[model samples]
Target chain A: MMNRDELRTALIEEITRVAPDLSADEITEEASLRDDYDLDSMDSFNLASAIHKRLGVNIPETDFARLQSLAQLMTYLEKHPA
Target chain B: MSDFLMPSLGADMDEAVLVEWQVKAGDAVHRGDVIAVVETAKGAIEVEVFEEGVVEELYVPVDTTVPVGSPIARLATQASVTPASHTPAEPEAAPNASVEADWQPEPSARPALEVSARTEKNDRISQTPTTPPERLKASPLARQRAARTGQSLADVTGSGPQGAILAGDLTSAAPQAPAAAEPKGKKSHAGFNPAEMRKAIAAAMARSKREIPHYYLATAVDMLTATHWLEAYNADQPPEKRLLMSALIFKAVAKVLRDFPEMNGYFQEGTYQPSPSVNLGIAINLRSAGLITPALMDADKLDLAQLMTNLQDLTRRARQGGLRSSEMTRGTITITALGERGVDSVYGVIYPPQVAILGFGKVSSRPWAIGDALAARPVMQATLAADHRVSDGHRGGLFLDRINQTLQDPEQLNQPAHQESES
Candidate 1:
């Protein structure tokens, strides 16, 4: 199972890769992904691919659709703990 | 009369549901006319008539599903009719007759025919109990080549002993020669690849940015009224029938597009070619496949219930990679919403030939000036990308204005309250 802190760090790192202008400080555990960082659909897809490659976790399309904020995504990752 | 077998829609489709019967028994169906609607993994697709004739039989009923390649209906020709004896053994006769006809070619035309005949005679002798061939059998290459081409081993000629077939003889005797002109060094660069997907994105985005001059217009619409309306509506609705904000947006978009037909077209051949019907393509992200845009046909004609059904069907098939070729084709406009994804604003690229693409961002709590006071309200962001070639900036602005107006007022959307309640 992935640890919460590690998962959060990985998520931040992945997000930063797509949006190079975005910094790690911009994304927090509880912050809204869309409001805090302008991650659109393509960015979300890229992040999902990055997570799959790094964490070996399969996020189904439905789950990806439901993920809204950093907190929600973290909770989802835990439930589907990889 | 000859039976007309169902044409395979594609290599992937295994079975198709007979959604509707376009021609009843005894009705004449012309070639290329839609005879029935088949519901495959893709969507409800219309099957066209291949042969023109009177519909003699309805083997499959409406809503009844049949396997692909199975005869769903039969056509009557001028030929004499035979009793319905569609047995497993029937298919064999057709293939055998064709095979026999295929074999009746001029002997002199084929140089290796005499050698093949001699080899077959030798093989028959060697197989007999009285005598055995000195050699163990055929070469590995010859056997592999024969298997690959579906050629009979006995039919191959031999350059060897008392007429023993060798690999070279078999290769020469092969009726169809593999094309040597085909460039073997070059790899197959066709079909779907990652580079292609990226290129498609690049092309679409480039076209959207350059030709379809887009103007960004953001509006803060109060969802509280819509929220209250939804809550009251959902209380009476079954859990399954409950309307999502996405559905409301879809209905609003449909209604708005009906008013402005120009927005429901593509900029083709230096002119705006408006479509007769409104087919909306929704972009869905799949895990395995990067992203897919599956279309919902006749969105303007569908009721709320039918729209919901179509949405569910499109999304389901999209994820399964079972979308039909037609579903991805002929989309007049596109609507993409990151409703639950929680994005505040997204500037979407116009899907080509399409005049506009509507993008919906997530609803979030933001401070708003309500009358004279500041208040926190749930508001969403919408961006419309319009084809500058067909529509001017003023017309695009007007279209967006209509969409915003419709979405803000829930009562306007729920015009037929009686119909909603009955459902």
Candidate 2:
């Protein structure tokens, strides 16, 4: 089982690891990772790898399409526990 | 005894400053052991010694700039009697293995003899020689590992002689969590000046355009089938495991390269040598300035999933300035994709020695004609820039057509690849 704050912190850490250009504060919960960080598909894939490495969850490609923001990723992680 | 010469990293590289020695006198080193670190136009490269032996003497000291192919150190090779008798504990089979090794002349062997007018002449006109600067004593591999882990060497206390940094020092210096958080600020300490990188790129591209007789070709490919296949394939998987359009493109290019060997190797000294393996050079743009195209080794043999993983790793390492000496030089054919940036098409200049470069544009929907009907379909432009000396327009066109055909049947990309990809 996962909580909201834990998931958010993990996602933020993963994002920061993949795209060092973006700060933790800049990656708002509501803003899309692509829009805010210029996270193209490659960057998105890297983020996914980071998440998999950290949380031990394989985020499906379909689920990736739905995850536009940090909030969505956090929610998805909460629902699909590692 | 054999001379360990300074290796020429690329056609554009003429000289490099010997940064530090990873090995010392009386150190028992193997064939592939990294003996020294040298700072080239590209960056810090841990130069490997190809011959197994003990160091007899280091001809040139650290912080001295030397010409390419100049003898940097002398190795008392196993071929010699005294060294072989002295190193009796070493694996006997390892010494004799070179006798059974492939007869093909090593490209790096005798760099002085192999220096051609094209590259050596290019180096004279374009090379910007820099005086050796005082650098932190660390192996190139250590530096790369440090960068990858988001740990900086600035604060780490070295364990090697004279407090020289080593890879082992990085792990204990900083814990992973807090160090990862501070990745951004520490990257600037890499000491990579964007201006120097720009000049290096300029020299390489200038030499490429001037020396290599390049012919360009482009084909508009329909991506509807591949798109649908990707969607269906990824529907069941998590976001982390999804396949992108670029991965498909890379797979297609790698597969097509197998059929057309002429477009997949280095053209050195007016001779076109075909490589047995398809080591795809992926052009990754650094955030600072210019780009570094590191090879995705044995790409043709990797399945689609493996390709994605390797590409991600290669790009991450490239951007971070953590590439190794071999990855920086061993590219057969290059693939440059501008699709993610929404560019319509990219016509790239062929990196010298490599005969060809494959380019991919953005994947977007456009009205396309199919027989008697017209429909809005996903289309992307694939471009090829090839050396005219090795391949004609027909061969280049066929290569592009093969890639398009492969992508049309994207299912093959996921299939188990041929086991043997090497010569």
Candidate 3:
């Protein structure tokens, strides 16, 4: 199991993989990936799947919309322990 | 037995430099093998061979700039057909890294951008050559860097095979050039120069508008049924397997194209040739480079899931510079969809040799009329920019409307598409 710091790093990696134009320096923990970074619907879906593949977490459609921010995504991952 | 020539990437390209050889002499290769990587104005493209054979000889050395259709290699397809093809079949003797790099096209030939004339266009580039023009041997990389750093090739001495100039030669000769001053990481981040790419795109668009008489049409599609269907369809699927709404749009357009053959093929030399298959050129935006619209070949044939997989694979490979020659050139028509983050509607300029281009904009919540009452619903704006010589506004309108109608029956999209007019 990855610790808190490692989990945050993994999530950011997934985000950048989808949105190559985005950088780690500009991303804030509480900011929305779509609202802040301009990731489209397909990009968002790809990010979700990429995260699922990397961390072994299955994100449901209802919960995907809720986990828009890094903090929310990390917290959900920690709770689920996937 | 046969000479494998350098292929022209598309109407946008003139020539390419052999970047590297993936297969050497004596190597057995099958059809669709990526035997070489060549760099064009649009970064490196993996060159795939169509014939199954043994590599008999490597003619062009790595880093040598060869014209489109120039013989780059010799393949032994049949043992009896090789006429004095005796080159010892030795891989080590073949030009690897240190070949004559100073292969440059004559100044006049380099500037011959003959994309405007209507007669014998793309075929002219591939057919019989009128004596390979006198060339000043210089690697394309060195030439581009030389132009960037204001270093003239005439002044530089070549150390490569046959005294041809190479990229390494430029840095050592002109230590003060900006190409040397830049940090290592920054150079890669600055992918194939965007300024040059912009120039190429601008020229193509300008020529397309100048030469092709275009008629435009747009329609607003209500996605209440389609979006709901997509949502329901994806509800049971995992994240990896879930399909994008655009994939459905691709499948729908491909299906509707069968009924409207006029809007689904190429137009050149005062003739409209409707292709036997629907090769939808999809515009994929690259983070490093500008944009490339390679074909999602035979988009009309694949089911939703297979189409989704190909689209995703094409997108990934396109970004990574792993595209084939046919995908780069043989697109019957093009579809440009501005993703969810883009504007409400898009009107595209038709890619040349192709008669029509379809554009899709972001799906937004708009006031839609249901019976006498009006309510907000998910709506997408679809537009068509087609050649006036080939298709009329009436045909274009029906084409757009069919796409909208096809989306209303999303379940039908999951089933196999009946192959149409093209063989």
Candidate 4:
């Protein structure tokens, strides 16, 4: 099982990688996905696709927007372990 | 002594009205401190002090619509010196103009100082021109990659004759763009136009191809179970709350990254800097602009409802060209889906920092042996492009296996009872 902190950190690292402009400090639990990061619909799909390929978990669109922060994402993943 | 000029805040506003002054004559002010409030087309914004010194004079009155580049205030050093003559110079110049004039010293002395500075700056510029070596021309993308990484043209050994830079030169050089160009959205380039956005895609992809050491792996998985699960779930949910295949893929990817931490970091400073959160970036294909990858922060944390909302919001904004700078940064991995348009399999290029990229291709019906009879099933092909520097082909294959395993088992992805009850 993936630890919460490790999962959070991995997510942040991937975010910084794909979006080179964002720093780790900027990604917080309260950060809004669309408002803070400017991710568009297609970008979100691409993000999901990338994660699916790398991490092996499927994130349903029904759960996409609800994930606002690293902490929140961890809870969702724990409930729906791949 | 120097004059502080009111900066042109925007292109539309020709003049700014001074709202208030936060400093007074003789008061010590530091650079970056709020010195005054100026009203522009957008709204009132605080202007910061650009230099540290005592406030010597206030040139513009509050509420005055001062033209852009006009001096709003003056700063004085501890040593007393006569204020240089303004002499109807450029209208309303910054205090720096006077300092520049005073510092000119004499015409005879100016040449020696200028010559030295010029030589130093020229030396640096000559070291790295925009042009790439001969072989790099073969791949326009390679030349662009060299330019973006700020590799000293002189330092890169060209495989082609005439000591020209090549696509191979990028192997040893760092993948950082030269500081010479301001980051995205700050300035327009001759070759790349921000208005079209394709320039960004081309630049990023070129850089990724040239700089990232990529190793690709592919996997084909049965999508029938997941497809059935999604259809059943959507039937009971509202249209707005319906889950998308992309979201499901993202959730699975996020979970897997936790197990293989190496893929979720950037190779920097001779080491991989692991990130603290999982912010996924999605690649969007804008018809006019080739492609743009905007980020979704903390994809693992959102519920189905929130995911749908966020996805909808991001897509809406992306189509309208409303993305911000922050959205473009810090993605650990990338996922691309060809949806109905893609072929059965695709091997993506590895996006830097993050060691891998996943490509999801179109789902198709294929024959499979179930017991003794032949069965046709709908399946999708997934490809992984990983950075060879961090992960080998074996590990990359294993990562794909994990994703395929999760995707094949649809019942395991049932929404939690608590989550269902809350909804």
Fnat of the models, one by one? 0.00, 0.53, 0.39, 0.03
Q: How much is B73 displaced in model 4, in angstroms?
A: 17
- What is the lDDT for B203 in model 3? 66
lDDT (tens digit, per residue) of candidate 3 on B1-423 = 667767667665556767568899999977668888776655567787766689988987775777665667777675443322221111110112122111111112222222222221122222332332233344434555665687766666554434445455666667687443543321221123344455667766777888789999999999888889888887898898988898999999988887888987777656777777788899876533467788898888888898998998777666545677768776778898884656788889988778899999988899989999999999999999999999899988989999989988898888854433233
lDDT of 4 by residue, B1-423 (tens): 766666643212245556567788889976447677654322234565545578888877665666655566767753333222211111111222222232111212112111111121122222444444332221222244444665544465443323433333443354344323323321111121122233334544666677678888888888888888887776565434567777777767766676776777666434665555566667665432245555676665665556656766665444332343234434667787765354687777655546688898877888877899989988888899888878889888889999898787655444552553344
State interface RMSD in Å for all models. 20.7, 6.8, 10.3, 10.6
Models sorted by TM-score, best on top: 3, 2, 1, 4
A best-first ranking of the candidates according to their lDDT comes to: 3, 2, 1, 4
Residue pairs in steric clash, candidate 3? B101-B139, B102-B137, B102-B138, B103-B137, B103-B138, B276-B422
Model 2, B1-423: lDDT tens digits are 666666666545666666567788788787557777665545556676656678877777765777765677767676533322322111111111222111111324443332222122122221342332234444333455565776655556554434445443554454463323334322312223244456767777887888789999999999999999999988766655677788888888887788899998877656777877778888876542346787898788888888887888777666544455556667888888888778989999988778899899998999999999999999999999999999999999998998899899988678866542442
Q: What lDDT does candidate 4 reach at residue B321? A: 29
TM-score of chain A of 2: 0.92
User: Which residues of candidate 2, in runs, are more than 4 Å off?
Assistant: A1-8, A25-32, A75-82, B15-21, B37-43, B57-67, B80-191, B236-242, B419-423
Report per-candidate TM-score of chain A alone.
0.89, 0.92, 0.94, 0.81
Docking level of model 1: incorrect
Docking model 4 quality class: incorrect
TM-score of each: 0.49, 0.72, 0.75, 0.47
For model 1, how does the per-residue alpha-carbon lDDT over B1-423 read when each residue is reduced to its tens digit? Answer: 344544444222344456456688899865456776654433345566534578877776664556544556667654342222211111111111222111011122212111112233234333322222443234333443454567665555443434444334444565374413223211110011222244445655665566567655665667767767766775565434555677677878877787788888656446676766677878765321245566787676666667775776666455422344345545778888866565687777777657788888887888989789999887887778776667777877788788778877877676653453244
Clashes of each: 3, 7, 6, 71
By DockQ, rank the candidates, best first.
Answer: 2, 3, 1, 4
Per DockQ, the best of the predicted structures is: 2
